[model samples]
Target chain A: MSSAPVHAPASNDVIATIRDKALWIRRRSFQMVYEAQLGHPGGDFSAADILATLFFGVLRYDPERPDDPGRDRFVMSKGHCTGAFYSVLAAAGFFSESELSTYMQPLSRLNGHPNRNYLAGVETNTGPLGHGLPVATGIAIAGQIDAAGFRTFVLTGDGELQEGSNWEAALTAGHRRLENLTLIIDRNRLQQGARTEETASLDPLDDKWRAFGWQVEVVDGHDHAQLLEVLSASPRGRGRPLCVIANTFKGKGVSFMHDNVAWHHGVPNKEQYEQAMAELV
Target chain B: MSAAVSVESGFFDCRDSFASTIEALAAADERIVTVVSDSVGSSKLNGFRSKFPERMVNVGIAEQTLVAVGAGLANGGKVPFVSAASCFITGRALEQVKADIVYTNVNVKLIGQSSGVAYGELGPTHHSIEDMAWLRLLNNLTLIVPADPWQTEHAIRAAAAIDGPVFVRVSRMPVPALEHAGAFEVGKAEVLFEGDDAAIIANGTMVHRALAAAKSLAGEGIRARVVNMATVNPLDEAAILSAARTGAIVTVEEHSVRGGLGGAVAEVVTAHDPVPMRIMGFPGFLPTGSAEWLMEHFGLTAAAIADAVRQTISRKR
Candidate 1:
């Protein structure tokens, strides 16, 4: 496996770069979604920063050698956020930035969700909620089996966690003491429906993860410095998995759509798209 | 070839053979592991658990988690055989089986114990007659349904040696050993008895029935070729095409007529050779009964299978 040129920047500097990239990703993602006339823009905006940080800074992956055995595996379990994912991958040099225009078009590799068969950086084809964590657990276990130091990280929605399979995987990850596995819940309160609290209160969500035997950490999902500090921190309680509860707004960086459930799968019209892009600028 | 050589019968459950073979394999290979969904005693994996406690993961009634965890374990460099009730293993954790195991092409062996109506009076919920159909739809999965105890043991050992996703349905119902001591090929079908008149292709608990059906057909002055098709996915197209050349074929299975071994055989025969075929199995929902009674009711017995072969052959003539 060929290693990417590693420039060891100060942690703060890396965070700042990630923040700038996240803004760019949000703007690009919104444009793509608007042009496509179909996509979950709300979740994409909510998760753009986290996706940017992981693809650019946190994950040790070479786009040229996507299937490298030693590469850290990342699964976008909340697959509805494909716009953000595609934007981040383009920025990471997995594919050309021009390819973003092809998203959701006829015969486009960029589908509604991440598909490993078509896309480069995607580890698994995830769309249905609660699937990514289990698949990530498998990759983590595979890493352990080969005694490879590569870690597996999965990004799931706070609402997507409602699926029982995620909890099932959580228990197994904890029981197996898969220290190499990390789960980052994009805890943007709004879901496809109303607010998560109104739909099904996942308040005390951190306790729920801790009770399941995970090393729990909460971070301001939009704050690049805080995100980097929490993400790079090693698993504190040995033999337990790590779960980072990332508090975020549903439609971060977009003023009208932020924390709004209607934007969950809403396609922004020309005016809204212009306004969202202007805000990002 | 003469009619299938019938010997004095003795009843033995294939699960016992599976347990013993798994135990032996685990003793030889440290990488071999078993993950059960709270079915240690039911799956007859008590000995495997006792010998390899660390390797035996009892996930305590969570079927989906059992499969997911097994996939996890397999990912971690362990050859994991996920042991659970076939009904739950295939039905409950189907998506996990698709996503984590088969679609990902992980080297996980899913052992569906007590497949078919093996859980007999426990009701339809416990019956795993749909396992074959459900698993067959997935890609990169090798589906096997062993005929008897000897075949079951061989399948277990062979699966461990192969490095890919496999689902082997082990019958809890007692069956006399079918295959004699021989090498177990993963995808090759065993031509237990051969005749050009007509063909009877069967798998799992139904293989013995097909053999017996051949004998009864012989008594009726008919020579029926009997093929024990253990591997369902990478089907023996050569054998099936040869059987198709026999003018007529009869497929028998312990599952539904839809998408089981019978369906697979018919698919091959119809597409290439277009032979006169009769698919015999549980056609629809079965009423509650003992396993043996259900088999008889569904015309899965030797006499009924022979009758179906005779009928199909007569149609061809």
Candidate 2:
């Protein structure tokens, strides 16, 4: 594992400090994608801040003990955004940061999808949508079964919600009253082909979740402090699951890619990559 | 029909045997858990649910979640058996079966109930003729298709005892008990009958058909060997080779002709010693009919299988 970065706090004090680190991860992730000339950069950029906050501020995990039974679990249901996940894991001291350059290279452990067999810190292999929620539910149920205090969190995309498996898990989790399970939807409206609204609208999303028996919380996903507050709070209603519907841009930090449909899986050219990096700095 | 002396006991659905065996296993071990997709009553698992409510997780009407959740439960150190209709379990949740259970090498038992044309009236949507092919493509998965009630019980026990992923295809169609009272093994093929002219190998519900076909061949002075190959993945290469040495081999199954028991046996025979062979199965999508009618239509009946074997034997000379 590589040494963790030592950094000076930013001017905005608490929020900017976390935002700066998140921006750094986003920049590095973009560089890897650009270098490899392949990756879902839009989703990664959209999800970077949440990843940074969870790994650095909220999640109760020890990098040294990835398999600690008592540690809280995180599942990346939108596994195409693994560029963001790998960058955060590297920053959190799970592996060498230099290894991020190997992102889609031949025979690289970092394949198109995150595989648990070759990497630590990956809870499960999830490229296909709607798989993470059920697995996360199982983790939460396991904690309840063992009488452990560990919590389980899963992040999914807005369009991925079209998959019916998520609703199945949602119903079961709420019915079981698994207070330890938290679902964080990175509600970046754009999907691979087009905007989620144009494809299959998942609006009334929060109400749908609430109706399915979850305590729904809507928040700005990019706001580090708000994310931390909502994430750290207790499960809202008794005998129900928690759903944090974090409203997010398809591409958050990069000026050119932000809210741009074409950037859903677009790799930046050299000049474009440089421009994005400069904005981050 | 009078009870045949060859069949030990009366007819019974293997799903019953599976549930009873699983209930016994769960009682002995606290780690054993059952996950169903609203199929508790259909799979004959109501007794299991009543006995161990905590261990029974019924993710109603969601096959994908059922399978992925079973993988997660396995990851949590519980040996989970995910039970569902074979068509839905194997077809709908194929990616989960491949990624979560097989690729991840999780200790989850995927119990595919009512396989083949068991749901006759429900039409092609419910028929699971392609499950064997789909499951066989996955690596590190032990595929066991039990022939009868006794075999089903033994398969469940063996799967629970094994420490990795296993897929047991249980049938809702009634079958006479074929195996002796206490003789069952996982990867070993049982030689039910010995002959020198030709060999008939079968699996799942077709094992009895192969046996009957061999008995029919005996009347014509054409001796046919019968091998019950319950395990499809780790095929009994020795038995297959021995059968190939007899100059002709015939494979019978309730699955599609492609990538099933027939395909598995063909792969083995072709590699070891190329021989004249006849593969019997549903060649394509079958029309809706009664289970028995569908079996006969697909040439899965004993007489049809014997005729095919005889044709292959004649082709050898």
Candidate 3:
């Protein structure tokens, strides 16, 4: 179930639609991971709301014209967490919802990581950490050079910032004043096995972006209203790239897995799956 | 016989050819963009930066971002040439090169400047002798190691025309302009000279020296054929198999003896038609010396190649 992609201040209707999609995303993504017995469900659930907000409301893309030069771009930098990504993409009509069953199966296009060549809405191939932002920066630079109307957005994991490549790209994007680009850091605290603060701290992250010449905005990542408000805002005359620090929990929807690092790479057991699905709403 | 050995038809650095060709390409194609890592001066792109200031995207000395940005530019439909010191681009930011450019299958042109031991006295830290070995592993990536200025120009143009990832290894080392009547193709090996006794397959800065080696070998009554194989990833199998027909193959390059042009040639010759092969190049991290001195010290000269070809011929079945 997909809403018409919108770009206005979040009305109650739009917020409800995003919340519905987000819940669906959380439920469907976990189901895929549970069936496959493979995926970063913690990261996926953490990023589900953001992905739902983007695909259903903020991002302007025609699933039929996925390769349209003028279409807005969303690069999932935290690519290992494809449970949420593939769900949002399917819901947005990039592919059929039934195809989720083939995810991570033999010869499936729905791979553990996203590949642009194989998947319609996937902008670039990403699995290795810290790769998405630089690529997004390059796309933004390309848009700026052409004076194109399409904006570029990238959602990166908090721990993924440990990679220096992101900062390298951040410097370039900020220096170029690429106002058309928006970087959304999924500040969910937990990484794979430990909290990001414990595993190479990334606090004072907003200050770091500011020093790199980016405008910073902190928001409740799961708040459809907050995500829509910041993301849909105009970049006109902004003169700089925007960095949205989306504060969230690792496993946002499920009670037992919420903010839990052990669930980062673990799949749900049959009973756990049913319980999580029940809690998703 | 020493570091003083010179190219027959005057000397030229392929980096000059690379710069001029990109400038010419950018003039015609509006989508052509250059992404460098504060390497405008090193890559000899000052003229290009001056002409098309906006098109020259200097990512400020970050090799990883330099390569990834090129991939992005390609995503944005601009043909981006990601240029940087060969050692850093291929080694320091290798994952980005693999994930962003190759695995992503983008049309990003990676111009690896001063490849091999062109850094000379700067030591192994800056030497990119392992680039071919590393890059040749990635599929869907066009690997071109131009022999001289002309081939360097042709390779750059060809890489631009192709709609995928390409790594054009350029050298600051002086080499002569080669004479060729046929057009340059991406995967075809150019037979500079033909002989039935033995073959010397070479590329990059070593092609000219291979020709010189072939000349001296002829005087000594040894007719050694010379094949300039610039494309490493998709080796010219037909040409290499034909060279293997000579019974003895001497693969020479301005790279590591383990896995560069020499190693690539051996792969074909061994699998299809086993032959006595002598892979000639540097051993590993070289001693402090000038570019020419190191080439001489490592036996990457015409005399050494000819000697190796002669030695390889003795083991012919």
Interface Cα RMSD per model, in Å? 3.1, 1.2, 0.6
Error of 1 at A194 (Å): 2.3
- Model 2: per-residue Cα lDDT over A137-213, one tens digit each: 88787777776777788999999999988988998898888888999999999989998999999999999998888
Total clashes in model 2, counting residue pairs 3 or more apart in sequence or in different chains: 0
lDDT of all predictions, in order shown? 0.83, 0.85, 0.91
The digit string of per-residue lDDT tens for model 3 on B1-317 reads 01222344488878888888899999999999999898999999998999999999998989999998998998898999999999999999999999989998999999999998888999999999999999999979999998878888889999999999999999999887788748899999989987999999999989989999999999978999999898987888999999999999999888888888888887887789699999998999888889999999889899999999989999999
| Candidate maximizing DockQ | 3
TM-score, candidate 1, is: 0.89
DockQ score for model 3, please? 0.91
Error of 3 at A273 (Å): 0.7
Per-residue lDDT of candidate 2, residues B1-317 (tens digit): 11112322466778888888998999999989999988999888888989999888887898888998898887677899999999999999999899878887888999999999888767889989999999988868999999987888888999999999999999877777774534778788898888989999998888888888998899999999998989887777888999998899999888888889888888887787699998888877778889988997777899999999889999895
Ordered by TM-score, highest first, the candidates read 3, 2, 1
lDDT string, candidate 1, B8-108, tens digits: 35767788888888888889998888888779998888888788886777666777778877776665577899898899999999988987788757789
Q: Which stretches of candidate 1 lie over 4 Å from their true place?
A: A1-10, A64-70, A95-98, A140-149, B1-9, B23-31, B161-163, B180-183, B272-274
lDDT of 1 at B199: 93
CAPRI docking class of candidate 3: high
Q: DockQ for model 1?
A: 0.41
If chain B of candidate 1 is superposed on the true chain B, what is its TM-score? 0.95
